[model samples]
Target: MRYKLIPFLLLTGSLHAQQTSVLFIGNSYTYANDLPNTLRQLALSLGDTVTVASSTPGGYQFVQHANYAPTLTAIASQPWDHVVLQEQSQLGALPFPVTTTQASAAQLVDTIRAHEACSMPVFYMTWGRQNGDDLNCPDFPFMCTYQGMQDALIANYTALAEENDAFVAPVGAAWSQVRALHPLIELYSGDGSHPSPAGTYLAACVFYCTLFEESCVNATFNGFIDAATAAILRGIASEVVLDDLTAWNLDVDDVDASYTSSTNNGWNAITYTHGGAGTHLWTSSDGQSYTTPDATFVFSAGGSYTISHTYTDPCGNSDTETWVREIVVGVEELEHGMWYRVYSGVPGQLEVRGLRGGEVLTLFDAQGRSVLQKQLSRSAERVVCLPGMYFWRVNDERGNFTSGSVVVR
Candidate 1:
């Protein structure tokens, strides 16, 4: 449970990166209770930073934001790490597929990606009308009931995120969880669509968990909501979000690592286990040396070695893990192709073994950007990679080989 942040990979204008710039694009659900400012204050109370700004027009949908001058201006103002898109409360579940929202969101994602490829487009999954949407009930009977509308909203937001490979903030799901557990809490205003102060605090908690990949239970922000109500909402939000982060497509900066060493012909075989499918890298005992992210390690020495693991999620957030132990090792045969990993990266020459002749080797950066390439004619090769996270894939002529990540620094 105790851990440190992996070396962070963020898009910032300067080197002193401490917080994420988040742009909220929605209507009253976001602007009510000054949600963006509330989130910023919450992050500050928790000793974290989140630069927040928003373009929230009352009753505006994604389609509306798509052409809204204020929205476009805010987006072009900076390279945002995350863009939270909240659809109009009632528009989530309409009579038709709501093709306009879909088109607008996709178009926004494309536009954002054009400027910052790492910028994540997060869909804000809103809650249902407290009672129901009587206005659209005649067109959609499903909207006649609160639960029915909630279900449809969940489906719509989820499909939107899935189709765009975007992230979703399941505030609606958290709202449902809270309603089921603590129905007395007022999450909605009298009109039934807009969020009450309590609801906005709950939304802030969910955002804290989603953006920071940490529990919001201990956060100090309660906004205008009372302590008792805030605590309850915080607990519900934290539980719902952290319990199954993958459901919300959130990747926490945590990893599980274990290593084993054996005195096999003087070869100490070290292995580590880290949760999730993110990219990883390990630091050697010297504290100055590192290896490409690897599950297993081999050392041809007799002494103690401490390896620190740094894992990065798809969006480039990082988590750190450390393992220390003593081991003995002996020279062994180089297993080419199967072992085409970082053998030793020292000085001017970076040594990598495990590639067969007639195989093509390619290296890619953490951003999936191609950095290096080579054709192998020997069982071993010394490929050059700058200081960063990279992976090498071998293709046999038409493309068939193994790939593994390697770290240069």
Candidate 2:
């Protein structure tokens, strides 16, 4: 059959909840060195039953695939979970002659849609080749910059995929990253147009990882390839981990900071009033006490202030929290203004209006100094006061207060 069966090694427990059957439609790039075969092998090793079928004629392009629309139509009729389409590498360089490729792909996609349900997803494949010497590569002069050519091809394919609402397997960039690590990996057999075994392995890994959301690290191939090649494939797979760190959730609210040791790990505090050392302290919210003795200092009235708390982890990671509480000491009941409701015919008491609560209502002078402090209950109606402007402060059981001033005649 002129078909090569490449082996795949897949890790255990790496298969996603939803397994998929895939189809590859392209030229030798899809089958070179048994890329599809290797992908099938990897899927099997991961405990997933993945069936791979490819219809690739050597040197075939999108226009060619369009011409061979019957074969593509037949393939599209199957219950395939995914279909990957690759274009000739150079077609992406310029938009002129290649618009045909896009038209063909779009038509073929429409054909596929007619036969299959709309939910079936198509994937765009990208290919890469080794850079060439500009002097010797004059014919296809642009090929000298292999990376640039690959990028152009990828961009072109990506646009087609986007237009068609297809997913993209960044195989070419994966190859480039590998080449950056070790430059010898080539997709071409000799002329940099066909894929080598290493190139095939990388392509398979990219496709498998992206399509099935499976990890390439533990992929087990069919023993067609050896350990060294498997190791390289695993390394390429690890490169896909570029997206792993984004999975972590970090939030300040998740950490508990109520105890001293807790503060060391997750909680900390800051002080504004006292100039003394360690006035602000922190502890873990886990019911542990502060390792160091600390006290919240008494604040002064009308004094500008700043109070803050900070928490940190062992890795020297930290965040700060702050609260500003101004202290107006000796704030009496008169701190808040008092008014009598005219219709009630009763003098307004600080406690009744919620300005000052409890049996005691103390008046404070303009200097915040206490003038006359009196204890009044809710039953107290007539408040006797000398004529003066006094500040009245009222507080609830929770210590939250509403304060105003009253002029007693």
Candidate 3:
């Protein structure tokens, strides 16, 4: 369901508490060194809470997990905010158009959405082998080098995310950046396939930034790495994930700043409402501002006002929208000392009084469409119309103008 806010009298600062629940599904790549728990600890250090659960067995594949009972059971166990899907390390780097892996990932995403419509399915893009895929290098020469393998993984994961309408953690992309900037750092285990503590730590940092949509630069949980190395890893994660969110499809579900407005007393008692996933701020040209998602403004005077609403997401991404409206309040005198009044007490009629002869009076509907225009020949007139709000303007022969609004019930 979309986020909604009700009208409130008081405007307060927006406070956010970052809390998330995630389910990890993969093989050794995800289970090695307990990546899920590492992410939870990392979040704890940053004053956030992350509940984690996983289903990882040795050498598991996306196809296997899609049909696996344990995976399905975990998905139905609770409403998770995110479901991380990590294919076997080598499967994603296979030759182009790996239909089986892509199809299996799609199937899993379908299951995830069926269980919880709001659960965001994220593809955990893993890095290539430390050296290369010697087994597949003979057949597919592209897998012979670490760079080639990493490139394939990046492409496949990005494609899978797009096809499944999901998000990508881009761990492999960050891994490549780290390898280029800090070649001395080792990100692989003894077999050159599994992740060492450093490798898992880097992956955890990437996930922390991806799932929370926030930076992990100052995270206190080093996760078995020295502070210096952890800091370097965190920087890489930020550059890869936060720098270009659209590249990884992270901005697909960003907040929308559009809103709806209504008023019963012309411009006064105007209420603005919105449905978005973040904090809201409403500002007016007349120096009025409110920090509520939905608010009612009671203006004493009426004129042309430009109102803008800005919505900010949890990750500090924001969007602003503006609207200009003309408002007419109760009866008021014009500069030439001519006064006018609008009354709707009579059934199905608008009784406009105190009008000078030979004045041009125009009636506009709620949508600003001119419904009636006439040159008045008397001091009083009654206009027959349906029940609704309308704006009326009177222009005198001497170039003086008077305007107001009336609601016919």
TM-score of each: 0.66, 0.52, 0.67
lDDT of 3 by residue, 178-275 (tens): 88999999999899989889999999999988877788886889999899999999989988899988889887667667663232333354556564
Candidate 1 clashes: the total is 7
Give per-residue lDDT, candidate 3, residue 116.
87
Model 3's TM-score against the true structure: 0.67
Count of backbone clashes, every candidate in sequence: 7, 43, 0
Q: What is each predicted model's overall lDDT from 0 to 1? A: 0.72, 0.53, 0.82
Model 1: colliding residue pairs? 266-329, 266-330, 267-329, 267-330, 292-407, 336-354, 337-354
Lowest lDDT 10-residue stretch of candidate 3: 1-10
Model 1 TM-score, 2 decimals? 0.66
Residue 157 error, candidate 2, Å = 2.1
Which candidate has the top score in lDDT?
A: 3
Q: Predict model 3's lDDT versus the native.
A: 0.82
